[model samples]
Structures are given as structure tokens and as C-alpha cells.
Target: MDVCHYDVQVKTAIKEQKAEAIVLTDDGMNLTAFWTRLLCGCGTDGRFEPVYVMENIIPLFDKSFNYEIVERESWFYGEYLQAFYTPEANKIVIRDDVYERALAGVALDVITIAHEVVHCIQSIVMRFLNAMQCVEFKTAICSNDSNEMQQHELQTDRITSLVLSPDSLTEGKTDNEILQQYFINPLIQFVCGLIKTAGKNLLEALNDTNCYNEVKEVERCAV
Candidate 1:
């Protein structure tokens, strides 16, 4: 069985080996913050400018994030698959139709890019963690590890919304205002609100600027 799917094994590894215990829980917040700061440098300037999808996000993955966008037929994944990140190839593959809709500013398609961006972020951090010798942490992030794939996916979705539409940045705006301002899909905004209600601490931690230590540490060690 894939140990990545089993939180018990990860916990046992952390306990027995005394690892720093960086996994997909609180570290997810840190990962999101680090990437957001790296991409936009918005909050650090004290202005907290909102990130633009077309101008900021697309170019982010294209250039700074070190991932190439490859477009193919929509049915390449046998239909219904819009986009995905391939860690080995370091590419974000988008279906042709989805790519066109994103270019056309379709809300859902545009947000799809954000989703894969999180996947790319997770893959980078996970690889670095593995190199740092968190051997048990390796399989949990495997794309083929069906055990916790859904959990990873859910966290990725939530983190995508947090990056695109942080409550700290968009405070006092109604749902409609957020949608227009952030270019976020309506469903994503709604789910973000629901999660904001369910987990106040997680949201606050992710919005914290100091929470990027994991990413900074990874960069430092990689050099």
C-alpha cells in the first residue's frame, strides 16, 4: 500500500525519526504564502495590491515559476480533464479548449490555472522535503498515490482560492465585488467563504506574511 495515503505512517515517521513534521496541514498555508509573495510581492510592499489573473498569474507560471504550458486536444485525457501538472516534465498541460476559454477570460478556465499552479507548488516543496530526507513524505505527494489523492486535491483547491482571493486583501467586499475584482469563479468564492467559516486559524495563518519560512528555507538549502 502507498504510505502517502496513510497519515498514520507519516505521523509515526515524524514521531520515531523526530522529523520537523512538515506535511500538508499547516505547511500548506506556508507554501501558499511563499508562492504568493514570490509571484506578486504584493503584501510586502504594504500596498497589498490584488493579483490580476491575466496579467499576473499566467505570466507567473510561464516565467518565474519555471513551468511551461502545453496545450493539446481537450479529449487527450479522455474528456473532462482540463489541466494537470506533470512533475517529472515540469509542465502544466492544458486542454486546447480550456486554454482558449482561459485566454477569453472565462472565469472557470482561468481559475483552472490557479489550481494547477498549486499542484506545481506542492510538487516543488515535496521534492525538496524528500531531498531533505523526509523519505516518508515522498509518497504522500505522488500523483498516482490514490489513497490521499482526494485530500491533496481538496487542499489544493482551498489553497488556490486563498492565493487568488485572500480575505485580508479583499476585506469588506461583497461576493460580487470579489468576483469582479479578483476574476475568481463564483463557486470558488463561495467555497472559500465556507472554508473561511470552518477553519479561521488556517485562513489566518495562510494570510500571514511570516508564514513563508518553509519556502524560504527550501530555497536556501537548494542553493
Candidate 2:
């Protein structure tokens, strides 16, 4: 198993989802604002509507995933918990308190929701690999005790940080420059590159009729 290749694929999937979300907006004028809300949830003073933000995200998953957003009083644990993604139900649950906080101008909830969205993408990739009968790779991803899972979680955190702090990557800095200035781990570049590729593939797969059934098969396995 080429672990580097797998990491790249996962990261690409994430980037593809983000790109898809960006294009969903009308006139593409809100690109920066959309990312801002997603990353930092800053400056949402009547300027950023959560509904529109969600609308952009929900479509990134193909129909087979049955992605739904529900606001509940408590999801899983309790009030301290903000949100979670359930693979079996194919649902993303946002705690009412978190929603309220966002409504009251809290940016952290936005980042939390985005993090859960990354989990959704992870679930999708895992299911896709399972459907393709890549047993070894699937096992690597699904095994709870594996170091792969820990690294994946860390990678997700890094990607989330980069997305929220776009300035680090886009402020006339090369990937190397950003890495040094931000003190980002060297492994993150590989992960980030893979995410970019996976995102492109995911977007293509979402639209291709031939891949539709394969995606549906993955969804079936999840249930």
C-alpha cells in the first residue's frame, strides 16, 4: 500500500469538496467570504447567511450519501459537544447551542462545522474504497487501532487550519515559504496535494453517470 498516494487522494477529495462549494454560489462573488465564514466565522454581521453557506456544502456529496443536517438539543454526549457526523445515519448533527452561538456571532462553530464536513468527506472516501474491493486499503482506513487513523485526524486538523487561514497559503507565498513561516509539519504538503487531487476526482465522479452506481454502492454499505 502506497501510503503517500492514499494520503494525497484523501486530501484531494477535501479540496475538491471545497472547490465545489465555492462554485455553487451565484456570480462567485462570495468566495472569500464563504471561506472566511467556513474557517473563522468572522464578520458574519448580516453579511454571511448560514443557509447559503450550507447550500454550498450539501451538494458536494453525491445522492447516495443521504447527507442531512439536523439541529438537536444534544447530539451523542451533551451540551459541551458542538456537532458530529454519524456514518450509519449519513447525518451531520449540529447542537442547538452551537447554532445559537453562531447566530450570536461566534466563529468557532463555523470552524467546528467545517471540521465535521471534513469527516463527511473522509467517510465518503472510505466507503468508495470499500466498494471498490480494496480490502487492505479499506482495512487501513477503518481499523480503529491503526496509526493511519491518528495521522488522518491530524491531517484533517492541518487542512482545516489551512482552509481557515488562507492567507498563509495565498499571501504571495510558495508552499515551501508558507510551511516555513507557519512552521507547518513537512508531511502536510503531501497531504494537502493529495486533497487537491481527491477534490477534483470527487467533483468529476459526482457528475459522471458511470460512477453514480459505484457511489451508490458505497452508500449502501454504509447503511
Instruction: Give lDDT per model, in order.
Output: 0.53, 0.48
Give a tens-digit lDDT track for model 1, residues 19-84: 111236444353444345445554422322221433455455455344434456213343445676
Compute the lDDT of residue 34 as modeled in candidate 2.
28
Off by over 4 Å in 2: 1-53, 65-74, 122-139, 143-146, 174-223
Lowest summed lDDT across 10 adjacent residues in model 1 is found at: 14-23
How many pairs collide in each candidate, listed in order? 1, 11
Best by TM-score: 1
**What is the alpha-carbon lDDT for the whole of candidate 1?**
0.53
Evaluated at residue 33, the lDDT of candidate 2 is 25
TM-score of 2: 0.43
lDDT, residue 38, candidate 1:
45
